[model samples]
Target: MIALHDAVGRLSAALGGSPAAKLAASALVEADALGLPRFGIAMLDEWAADAAPVPETAGAQAVSWLDCSSCFAPLAVAGTTLDLAGTARQSGIAAVFLRGVRGFGRLVPFVRHLADTGLVGIAGAEGPPFVAPHGGTRPVIGTNPFALAMGRGSERVVIDIASSSATMADIKTARMTDAPLPDGIALDGAGRPTRVAADVAALLPRGGQIGSLLGLTVELLAGVAGAGRGDAKGRGVFILAFDPAAAGEGIDWQGKLAALKSDWTDGGGYWPRGGALAAGTMLDGDFAQRLDTHLARMAGQAGC
Candidate 1:
């Protein structure tokens, strides 16, 4: 635990120093990097570019929201997302819309944090369009990521996904290395399928037509309806939360969940959310050396 905390401290130090507007966003993302290993991501550079996408100056305004049980609300660029959790505790459910901020990267830790606080968490977020609709020419919708988390005793089940065939950040890294992308991940500027990283201009949604619909739906729900950003400006977020106790009068939620788990075969799970957490997370020796070098160089540039 100390080792983990120390690593996170170093990383957060390296990622700190953003303008007021994006300061909250930068902190959230830096916290996010600490849990990458739990999901099998061993390299910090996975999301780092020439430099991490930290903010240098405040975007526009401070975050603010409205008071309602279940309503669409807008959040300022540096608005406190914790406000959403507070509203959920009061009303038992809330659907929050975030505006002027597009810093959402992964949904697991964010939602899990809410769940751990004794609320069921569900969220969807959309940013600038990088994923094109299936069979469409140019990119229209974002990757449209979504996440869900549930609290059970001391355990929290977390699930998150990007509707795109491939993650936008990974593609950016691939472009950095001039490496080829996986088949069917991205299309060229001319709307033609191509694996060459440098040629990638738009990404494809997962599952062809179906995934495209999900992606578009999230864009509408989060980007347009939630944040009221019809042009898909900045990051748009939609989050909902409800208390399980208030939801069910006397249901044995944990018992039922345990029974369901017993019915399933042992070791059966899905990616990202699935997988043995007890499993040791390690990178290849050569890759580890490279990562250390990269971190040292970044730390120096960060002036930490």
Candidate 2:
């Protein structure tokens, strides 16, 4: 098991001190622990190597323009921007947009960082085209994703979700592991429903219209804010942060949100197989304990 701090250290070095690299590592490691193939070991080497590559020019910053000529340079710059935004929020109003960057691996970890710091954060990204807009099978939209983080006293809640029903990475991972594709997630090379991951040629929106709408919203927010469109060549990201304490009702808001979450879980029911006695579950006794051990081991492997 790898402790979170140690994992962060190795990943930070591997990705050349970029925030995006750390976020990708966290996602991969966390997904590995959850037995999810898409965000697991398959990503480790590429992520590490991607971080270490030298850029032709160092990233530059201005009050209104942030420029990184090399694609990979933006990862470190994005991390720095997030740190600054988080720090600024400590003083008063806490919201800022980071634009003109590229090569962000995923959006989750950035928001997770804000949650860890006792603040709320949201991140949106527009990238290469992969999915089609509503009512169209042709690929015209990128698999944009929006991530959110909320702090609840000593604990934090994190959610990273794609506007599409499934991310292209998931399909690729499923192909790598020979896992069955989830229903309604993808289309075959011939643009037909296909369960074979290897046969998948493209991804589909999660709930058709609803998913497409969500994807559109994310693209507009990220793309229109000087971030390129989802189908555009370059990638862009927008980050927002908030300090609930600044609202003068942090505790109250937390309590209410917690209650709503509890109620929702109670009414909606637990996940499928949640109560089943599986081999993995039996071996670990509990998920949290198993995760702690796994993290520790990963940390050791990374020489952290």
Give the whole-model CA lDDT for all candidates, comma-separated: 0.57, 0.57
Per-residue lDDT for 88-120 in model 2, tens only? 465643433444444544456566667666677
Q: Show where candidate 1 strays beyond 4 Å.
A: 6-81, 153-155, 228-233, 265-267, 271-304
Specify the highest-TM-score model's number: 1
Determine the C-alpha RMSD for candidate 2 after optimal superposition of all C-alphas: 7.5
lDDT of 1 by residue, 1-304 (tens): 2233333344444544333223333323233234443222232333232432322223222222322112111113222345556667777676566644434345555566567677777878777878889997688878788788776443446676789988677887898999888898889999999999888889998989999988878888776676534433356677677677675757866666566555553568532341112223333454345445655876765554
Tell me how candidate 2 scores on lDDT: 0.57
Model 1 local distance difference test score: 0.57
Task: Indicate the residue-level lDDT of 112 in model 1.
Answer: 64
Sequence-dependent TM-score of model 1:
0.66
Clash statistics: count for each candidate = 3, 12
Report the backbone clash tally of model 2: 12
In candidate 1, position 206 carries an lDDT of 94
